[model samples]
Target: MLFTQAVRQFLEHLQAVDRSKETVKGYKAELGYFNHYLSVKHNGPVYLEDIQLEDMEAYMQHLKERKKSTATRNRVVYVLRSFYGYAVKRELCKKNHAELLEPVAIIQKERDFITEEELEILISHIHQPVIRTVIQTMFYTGGRITEMKNLKIKDVDLENEVIHIIEGKGKKNRDIPIGKTLHPILTNYFENIRDHENIETDYFFAIPKSGSISANYVNRLLKEAVDELGWNKHITAHVLRHSFGTNLLDKGASLVSIQKLLGHANLTVTSRYLHQDKDKLAEAVNLL
Candidate 1:
């Protein structure tokens, strides 16, 4: 089949499999690039059987020349692999050219996290109750922004002082301890802001004035707070998660516990947050 036809079939399969909108968009972009390359290099639409390893290599070079990040290149390559694998499964292609393709190595860079003092400063400056509660939730639970946004009132166990994360990364569920430090604030925020009549809706952070708060609004509020404080670090909701893990590690929390709390499928993913506290590392090394 023609390359464009194959791409259309692949996107249909992705939709059937319930892929996220963002994933669908990435697949579309990557496949579009592949189709464009085939058209430009071969002067017409190349059939699936005409794909070669050299074409894959040239595409990698094209991505590099365009200054795409290693992660972006890796994702595009992955999308290509998935598309070709599907094509082969359906007998549309004789072989998958992307099967042996290797993604570009992504360098591990240390992530930036806010210190306890900096977090305190940011919280002090945030006067809005809803926003403050959202920030506090991230600080205490180490939950992802999506998790926080999707939180349901039923997930919170006030009597037990824990928040149950029903849907997290990799579809794993876990309960996170809610500290007493944030309990009263959360309780008050819920009482003041939550609509008791609409208790059936699962969203925990919904505004009564609107349907639900978008993740973009959360990021905008965070950016506004960051800009007002004139902090040099690039702050995001994930940074709060990083800060939580760093603070716990600084206080001698174990890697295994951190992994479970963060709902990470792998211990290695949780380890990235462990070494973010340079001052604590220096102090420990000096003491040793």
Candidate 2:
């Protein structure tokens, strides 16, 4: 089978299995770049069997020479591994060249997060009620941006004050409690905006007469608000989630609880939010 043909079949399989649109789009982009590289190098189409382990390693070197970040390079490796894994399973290829591909070492960088005060300032600058509500929902729930974007109205139980996050990262579903502060915000949004806006879609957040709001739209709103405030902080919808987890930890929330709330697959993933300041570190030692 042709390399491109195998990629198409693998991507189609992702969609057929109910993978998120973002997942499918990401896979398509990564594989498309790989296909372009193969075609350019061979001066024509390449077959699945023609690919070797060296070809995969050479692509990683190419990404390095192109100055791609370690994280980006790792993502490409993951995509290739998934794509070729599918190919081998379907008998399209004899060897899984991507299986042996190694990701570059990634330096763990501290993620940026806002304090509750900063979050308030950021939200205050966003004047649109719809956008304000969306930002609040993101922070309060600590959900991934895509999960928030794809949230369905049916999953939100306002009366019970529980937001059911169905199929979050790793295909895991979890529930987040509606806090006292966010309860009123959500209630007002539902009654004043979502309910009366004539938004005829299953999505919780939507533009009137249009469908669900795009993730980029939310990020753009965040960027504009940060610019208006003249804050040097690089904020995004995901940062609100990071802030949520960080603030919870500052308030003495346990890692296990935060993991469940954030729908993290493990405590290790959730533990990254444990940012300790100098004062906190000093106090910890003094406690002994």
TM-score of each: 0.83, 0.92
Q: Write one digit per residue (lDDT tens) for candidate 2, span 182-224.
A: 9998888888877554666888887774667777888898999
The residue-by-residue lDDT of candidate 1 on 167-272, one tens digit each, is 4755568999888887887888778767768655667877666645666777778888889989887888888988889888878899899988988878888886
Identify the runs in model 1 with alpha carbons over 4 angstroms from their true place. Answer: 2-47, 195-201, 208-210, 283-288
lDDT of candidate 1 at residue 76, scale 0 to 100:
78
lDDT of every predicted structure (CA atoms): 0.82, 0.86
> Which residue pairs show collisions in model 1?
none
Q: Pick the candidate with the highest TM-score.
A: 2
Off by over 4 Å in 2: 16-18, 195-197
Model 2: lDDT equals 0.86
Kindly report which residue pairs in candidate 2 clash with one another: none
